[model samples]
Target: MFKTIKNDLPASIVVFFVALPLCLGIALASGAPLFSGLIAGIIGGIVVGGLSGSKIGVSGPAAGLAAIVLTAIGTLGGYENFLVAVVLGGIIQILFGILKAGVIGYYFPSSVIKGMLTGIGIIIILKQIPHFFGYDADPEGDFAFFQVDGENTFSDLYKTLKFITPGSALIGFIGLGILILWEKVLSKKGKIFQLVQGPLVAVVVGIVFYAVTQSNEALSISQSHLVSVPVPEDTASFLGQFSFPNFSAITNPDIWIVAFTIALVASLETLLCVEATDRLDPHKNVTPTNRELLAQGTGNILSGLIGGLPITQVIVRSSANIQSGGVSKMSAIIHGFFLLISVILIPRLLNMIPLSVLAAILLVVGYKLAKPGLFKKMYDLGWKQWIPFNVTVLGIVFIDLLWGIGLGLAVGIVVILLKSYQNSHFLHIEDKSNGKHRISMTLAEEVTFFNKGAILKELDSLPRDTFLEINLLKTRYLDNDIIEILEDFLYKSKERNIDIKLVSKRGIVENPSSFIKFFNERPKSEMSLS
Candidate 1:
C-alpha cells in the first residue's frame, strides 16, 4: 500500500475531485439534503472500501437510486424514515453476504453486462452535454426519469438553452481541453505526468478561473453552477447536518415498501456493477460477489446511520477508479479517506468548483464505457456475442438498465437453449434394427430444469419397439423437473415393447414409472447432489 501511495495519492486526489460534485449532485437529485450524498460517499469510501475484498471496485450513492430514494422519502412521509430502510437495506446486504448470495453476479450474461456499461455510457454523455455547455438547471449526476426540480433530464438540458452562463461554458471548455491535453499529451511526460492527475488539474483550473472572474463579468459560471458543499458556520451548524431517523416511521407499511425497494434496487445495481467492473478490469480480477454484498451492506448501514443516502458499488465510479490506475484496494481506501477529510476540513474550498469541470470528467468516463471499439470488438466476436451484446445495449439505451439486461439475458439464454436443443439430438433415428434398434441417450453433467425439455423429448420420442438405454453417466443433480419428465416418459413407455435400461451415478433405476417413490426408497445420500 505504501509503495503505491506516491501514485495512489495523486489518483485518489483525482477520484476525490470526481467524487465531490457527484456527492452534492446526487444528494440534490435524490431530494435529500445535499450533505447526505457526501456522507454516503465518505462512508462508501472509508467504511466499505476498508472492508471490501475487491481491489478496484468503488462504492457510493448512485444516480440509479435517486428515484427510489425520492419516492421512498415521500412515501414514508419523510426523509428520516427512508434512512431507516437504507440502514435495514444495508443489514440485508450483509445477510446476503452471509448466505453467499454473491455468486448471483456470475449469473449475468456478458452481453447484458456490456449493454449496461454502454447504456450508462450513453446516459452520461447525454447528461454531461448540458453541463459541458454550462447548463445545470437540474442537479448534476441525477439520472432518473424525473428530476428533483420537476423537469426530466433531457427537458432540463433543453431548458439550458434559455440560460447559458458564459463563465460556466468557458471554464467547462477550457477545463475539458486541459483534461484532454493531459491525457493525450502530458500523460506521456514520464513519471511526473503519470503521478500528476488530470481531473485534479481540471478541477484546479476550474477553481482558478472561477477565482479570477469572481469580480469580473467574464465568469460564465454563477453561484448556482458552482460546487455547493453545504457550509456550517459553527459547531452546532455543522452537527445539525446529521439527522436521525424517525424510528416511529419504521412501523408504517410504506416503510417496508421503501425498504424492499431500496434493498432490491441497490442489490441489483451492486450485482450489475460487479459484473460490469469485472469486464472493465484489465487484470480480469474477479470480485467476490458475497463479499461485495457484505461490504455494501456495511457501508449502507453506516451511511444511513449518518444521514447519508443508500450506497452501492457503482460501475461508473469503479470504472473511473480502474481507469485512473488504481492498482490495489488502497486506492479505494485512500479515496474514501479523501472523502472523509475533504468534507470535514476543506468543504468550503470544494464549493468553488464549477459543475462543468465535473461534467467534463464524466463525459470522458461515458465515452470510455460506450466507445466504438467496444461495439466493433463485440461484433467481431460473432453473432452469438453480438446478438446479446447489441440487444443489451439497445435495450438499455432505448428502454432502461434492468429491462435491457433482462432482455439481453433472455436472448442469450434462448441462444444457449437453441444451441442445447440442437446439440441434444445426437442422432435422428427413422428405422429400427432387427425389429428393435439399440438407442442410447447421453446427458450432460448437472443437467438442470433447463435441459429437461430437450433430454426428455429425445428419450420419450424413442419408438416402443426400440431397445433403449437412458444414460446419466456425467449427470449430476437431476432436478425434480427432469425426474417428472423422465417419469412421464417411463409411464408412456409401458404401452410399448421397449426394453429400457437406466444408467446413473445412483447405479441404476430400471423403468422408473414411479421414480419419485423409488427415489425416496433409496438412501438419501445416494439420491441427492453428487
Candidate 2:
C-alpha cells in the first residue's frame, strides 16, 4: 500500500473533496446532526476500508439510506434511540455475512445493476442542478423525487431558477470550466496537473472566489450556499457533538424492527455497490461480498457508537475513487484519514468552499455515470435487456432508488416469465390429405406454472376436426397445473370433434378415458400417456 502512495495519495485527496460535501448533505437529508455524516465518513473510510476485501470500493453514509434514516429516527423517538437501531443493524449485517447471504447480490440481474448505475448518475445530475445555480432551499444530497422539504425534484429546479444567486452561479461556471480544462487539457500536459486533480483545483478556486467576493453584496454567496460543516468553537464543544447510543432502547421492540430494516437494506445496498464497483474497476477485481458485509457491519457499529448514520458501500464515492485513479484500498483508507484530519484542523477552510463548485464536480461525475452512449448501448442489446434497463433508469429518476430497482427487477422477472411461457412448448401443424389439421405439441424439458398460460392458449385455439398430439417425451417435470389443463382439455376434445393422441416415454394412448386417473395412478417418476 505504501508503495502506491504516489497514486493513492492523490486519488484519496480527490475522494475527500468529493466526499466532504456529501457527508454533510446526506446527514442534512437524514435530519441527523451534520457532524454525524462526517463521523460515518471517517469510520467508513478508516474502519470499513481497512477491513474490506474490496480494493476500490468506498464506504460512507449513503444518500440512498437518507430517507430511511430520517423516518427511523423519527419513529424511534430520538436520534439516540436511532443509534441503538444502527448498532443492532450492524450486528444483523454481521450475521448476514456469517450466513454467506452475500450470494444474493449475484442474483440481481445485470440489466438491473447497470440500470442502477445509470439511474443514480441521472439523479445526481438532476439533483445537483439547483445547487449548481445557487438555490439552497433543498439540501445538497437529497436525490429522491419527493424531497423532505415537501418539494418534488423537478419542481424545486423550476423554483430555483427564480432565486438564483449571481455569486454562486458565477463560481459554479468557473469551477466547471476549470475542471473541464484540468481533465481535457492540463492533465494530459504534465505530471503536476495529473497530481492535482480537477476537483481539488475546482475547490481551491471556489474558496478564493468566495473570499474575493465577500464584500460585493450582489456577487456575494451566502453562508447557506457554502459548505456547512459544524465548526467547533472549542475542544469541549467539538466533543459534545458526538452522541452515544442508548443501550436501554435495545429492548424496545420498535428498535429491533428498525434495526432489522436497516440491516437488510444496508446489506443489500452494500452488496449491490460491491458488484457495481467491481464492474467499474479497471482491473476487473472482484470484491468478496460476504467479507464486505462484515466490514460494513463493523463500520456501522462503530459509526453508531459515535453518533453517525448507517454506513454502506456507496457507489457515488466508490465511482469517484475509481474515476480519480484510485488503484488500491489505500486510497479509501487515506481518504478516511483526510476526513478525520480535515474536520479537526481545517473545517473552517472547508466551509469556505462554495456548494456550487462541488456541484460542478458532481456534474462531471454524473455525466460519466449516465453518459448518452449508455442509452444507445442498452438499446443495442435488444428489447429484452433494454426494457428493464430503461425502466430502472426511469424508476430511479421518477421515484426513489430502491423502488426503482424493485420496479426494474419486477419488469425483468416478467420478461423472464414471458420468455419461459413462449419457450415452454413447440407446436407443429401439418395439413393432411383428409382436409384435417394434424398438430403436434412438444413440451420443454421443464415446464412450470408459468408455462400453463401459453399451453392453454394453444390448446383452446385448436379448430374442430383436428388431430392433436401431445408429446411429453422430452419433458422431465410437468407442473400439476399443466396436467389439469390437459385433463380438462380431453373432455373438450370430443365436443370440438378433435381427436387426441398422447405420446410419452410410457408409450402412446389414443382416446383414453379419465386422463387424470391414469396420470395419478402412475409413479411421479414415470411418464403417463393418456
Highest TM-score, which number?
2
lDDT of candidate 1 over 383-496, digit per residue (tens): 888999888877765555677788999999999887766664354444567878888776665566677677766776776688777777666556678777767776677788
Instruction: Give the clashing residue pairs of candidate 2, or none.
Output: none
lDDT for each of the candidates?
0.80, 0.91
lDDT, candidate 2, 1-530, per-residue tens: 78877788888988888899999999999999999999999999999999999998899998889998999888989999999999999999999999999999998888999999999999999999899999988887788999989999999989988989999999999999998899999999999998888889889989998999899998999899999999899899999999999998788999999999999999988998888888889999989999999999999999999999999999899999988889999999999999999989988999999999999988998899999999999999999999999999999999989889999999999999999989999999966748778999999998889998899999999999999988888987777888888889999999998998888787888977766875677776764332
Report the Cα lDDT for candidate 2: 0.91
TM-score list, all predictions? 0.87, 0.89
Stretches of model 1 off by over 4 angstroms after superposition? 145-164, 214-219, 430-442, 455-487, 490-530
Count of steric clashes across candidates, in order: 8, 0
- TM-score of candidate 1 relative to the true fold: 0.87
Off by over 4 Å in 2: 1-4, 431-436, 463-530
Q: Where's the lowest-lDDT run of ten residues in candidate 1?
A: 422-431
